[model samples]
Target: MKTYRDYDDLPKIELPYGKEVSISDSTLRDGAQMPGIVMRSKHKVQIYEYLHMIGIEKLETFVYNERDRKAIKLMQDKGYEFPEITGWARANPADIDMVLNVDGIEETGILMSVSDPHIYDKMKLPTREAAQEKYLNALQYAVDHGLRTRAHIEDMTRADNYDFVFPLVEKILEIDPDCTIRICDTIGYGIPFMNVDEPYGIPTIVKYLKNELGAKNIETHCHDDFGLAVANSLAGYWHGANWSNVTYLGIGERAGNAEMEKLLVFLKRRIKGFEKYDLSCLVEFAKFMEKEIGIRIPRNKSVVGQNVFAHESGIHTAGVIKNPFTYEPYPPEIVGGQRNFLIGDSSGIEVLKFKVQETLKEMMDVHIEVDKNDKRLRNIQADIQRLFNEDERVSCISDEEIRAYVKKYFMFNPIVDQELHRREDDESPDNTI
Candidate 1:
């Protein structure tokens, strides 16, 4: 269920979305390409399995090496419950042949370097001729092999204008319009500049392509040389791009590819009239990747971060105490996270009182009137805050403990002196302050 209150009440924008932006996690392949990164075949298999359980609609299993191809084949033979399996390849017949020989990868993406520099420097050919030939040949190869094709136009941000890309896409469509097209921000060079105040705009240049292309299959591949890759991906979807090439924790070449977790949350919360994707297992998958793959998730990283749900401001805490929605944009519980109230020396007494009251209420079903001048309650609150700050402990006192302590203090004002070194034990009748 949608946890945010305003999701349904959001004002409708009649922006035409072409193909649904499907996710393709490339954790095994592209994620492995990052320097000093490697995954055991078993872990790779687990990643694929977990992706399906998380409701990722597609899986691009990276380059088709013998070991990788074997893994993809096993998944195909085993019949994954979700994520239609696919592989990535250079825009060449040999590459396509590698994927075709895999026997069960339902789709294969052929990455063609369509930019002028790549054409001239890498391929030693003119942009137009090299692009058309590579794209056409790769498409035909995949088609003849009975595999769906995704034509990856690499370095598209720097590629010669739509005049080149559009024609190439048109020709590929002429051969097979059903083939998916990947508009890559290879260097993260594509800037969606809006007005001066909002320099980063939406329905980006890539989005415009997907919009113009309409239903002729499209996807997105982005790099984060600049930090705008995620923003670009979101804008792409809002405009029209349907397929998102992603990696675990955004791990890939350079700054990495689009973050799969960030994309899932954005779609779940931001998109209108969009449904049918399951995301409950995303946090579990992220934790697995962190533990097994050794990718350290930053504390401030989006939904799955260590501190994403941690709150500390007094005003924010008080508002949250009233209604979490007042301070939080969305309920942390929606993403398998809980709201945290961190008390410290800077926290005011009112906030501290509310925190203790809230903790007591949660710990027990009883209601006790706390006096402001009660020195014992003040000391307990101070201890609670101290313990929380120094050792990260919160509310060590249980309901029974609270009842026993509060009843003893309120009824008899137990300890006669403030400086008494008291060690009370609940389990033993003789052990007391």
Candidate 2:
């Protein structure tokens, strides 16, 4: 059987997107709106650098505050240019004017609500025509002021595309063909599969915009309310949308948007020539965001989470030790993640031996490696199993705790025991271990 390591060299199903696909970051805007996520200015700057370093093409940030303006200026001054900074704004001249002040932001997203709730209730516009008029005036104002516009169609999944959405897009295009449109599935109501109804099914919506409207530049701003953010974004790309909007760690309002890290990893696999992208900073970037905002990432979350590459099951660990592709889709190191053999309940005897090898290497001054076939290793594995299977409360065992067993059982051998004991007597923290 062909292994995952051999996947790049084999024939695969190519997606329908024309060669190059673009990605945009929305962490500075929508990500900030998530409850309890207040990203500091310095951390925002760091995130921008990380995203640009990983080859993301654009950043959609809020030009709504002083701190956001400051962070944009800082990134501009540093000269990291891959992610062209675009400011988000409401459909008004005053908000677009605020965008003009942010040093390097050339594009802005003007909010255009097409759904019934926003049209009549939230925005309080009497009619859909009036709402379209307001957005068109705002678009013209942005054009007149030397700025590109992205008319963000908010709540589009719940809107009437035939009567309202397309007309508004047509109006925006009439002024400037260069202006792009972002399809915002604001409430995460978009279903990403095919053959569903208009505004509900992802393929139909993308097909309409790409084929019917003949949209010049299209973008996907998806949400994970139904856990299909990435799926919908992929469907958009497959049909012909050029750009996808994402955030670090998928952090945003309620269920959040498509995760930038997940999207990159997905792209790197399907598209050829994407291998040169520098993804070394992605894992650390996720850690930084989690640390800064106190948002906890579920350990099993793909791409940047802690347990994506961690293994402890007996059969799986044995196979992975031989070749990681036996258990993993690809090497964890592809996204700057490391493979680890966790010692716990369900660990194979080989895993115990591997942990012992690691412990002896790290904590000792001498070379004393554990052989897999040694009787001591079997004994140690038996004892470790007893620690878990015998005790009802014990869920998992740590490497440190396993090392405690190794020390007690095998380290008292005649030759190396003398040096280890002498070091232990010295009472240094390293020796204490």
Candidate 3:
């Protein structure tokens, strides 16, 4: 049985035993920040249901306005135990109050811009120390108001982990021991390889947070500027982080956040204790995002794309028809997708035979097996090839088109054949006498 392998030569890091690894979704908050995305109250509610149905542990949302509050209330009405709805707010008293005003939200992510560029340039703070003090005060206020805090160290990959990031996180832990420290790679500059230096090394950052700071709960919040969001997030989990912050379809600012569907599939395949997740709804969720919410999901996107399980080439379709595992990594049904053997210019006799048999069985309640070398099957294949070759068709032949070809070539109707055979038997010489 060939399976995925983890060799000893690789830079290996094990998650600490007894720690719980879970996913926190930000599709409602960060994902909505994607330009041109308008997640109205109803959209938020539907997305929430899909996330919950797929087994996300937490979902963070913005609580700045009446619409946000109403959406939160609507999601909360369902009373799901997992995917505990949380709030995202800046490190200010006003933002904290907005979170507190919500009825069921008990925990909220407090934004702390840890990178020097964010502090000195974006925020125009006097110094890093001033920013640290302000952030600590906000965290203290949120804790004082009886709300659990998740200190989001925004842009941690570009910050001085020792001088600013570490010390600030240490102080945050001191304030709220149970607080989850979300290490944000806001610019997607994080590298997954081990032995890399800080501010870019995700494994190093997560290790220090878990081993050095004694942080109980750590979350990895990554972006995809350099396309390292998923890799960096996995690195955080491999080193010791317990939570991975994600958005559905990886929809967010810039290149977007780590895709929840991709991460879930990876975790289920590589790690233990992830067998509880029901991923069958992944494709449906992607369709909803594309059709209802107006998000454009690439057709080749992993796990939940239309082309993920579609086979088109001659050799590929033949192999899939013989054994699906030959061409597919996993069963399409696992992700709520069906196998599609597409007939294009590259399709071969084997695929045509399979299609002909299937079409016959479906259209006429007759099961007629045709060999790959059968003349009727060959004629149908040639006609399909002519459409692409002579007619210059560029698209795969649709099933309906294939059924028409089956009707044209295989003209033997089972009912008519049975009637003709009965007449022949009745007209035999012994019966006539």
Q: Considering every candidate listed, which one attains the maximal TM-score? A: 3
Tens-place lDDT digits, model 3, residues 1-433: 5453222222323355646689999999999999987888999999989888888889999998889999998998988897899999998999999999888889999999988889989999999999999999999999999999999999999999988789989999999999999999999999999999898999999999989999999999999999999998888888889999999999999899998888888777656555778889899989899988898877899999889999888899888888776777778877898888778888888887888899989987889888888777877777777777787797889999988887777765546766887898799977552
**1-433, model 1: which lDDT tens digit per residue?**
5454443544444336544557877777678887766787777778878787777777777645667866776676657767777778887888877776766667888877878888888888765786688678878878887888888878877866556876677778777778877778888875655331111233455555555655466677778889877877776666676677888689888898888878777777666655666676667777888888888888788888866776666677677776766767566766777777665544554555555565556656666555555686776566656666786654334445444545455444654443243533544477764
lDDT of 2 by residue, 112-192 (tens): 889999999998989988998898999999999999888899999999998889877887888878777889988888988
The Cα local distance difference test for each model comes to: 0.69, 0.83, 0.88
Task: Choose 1 or 2, whichever is better by lDDT.
Answer: 2
RMSD of every prediction: 6.9, 6.5, 4.5
Query: How does model 3 fare in lDDT?
Result: 0.88
- Backbone clashes, each candidate: 1, 0, 0
Candidate 1 has an lDDT of 0.69
TM-scores of the candidates are 0.79, 0.91, 0.91
Q: Higher-TM-score candidate among 1 and 3?
A: 3
Q: Candidate 2's error at 213, in angstroms?
A: 1.4
* Candidate 2 RMSD computed on C-alpha atoms after optimal superposition onto the true structure: 6.5
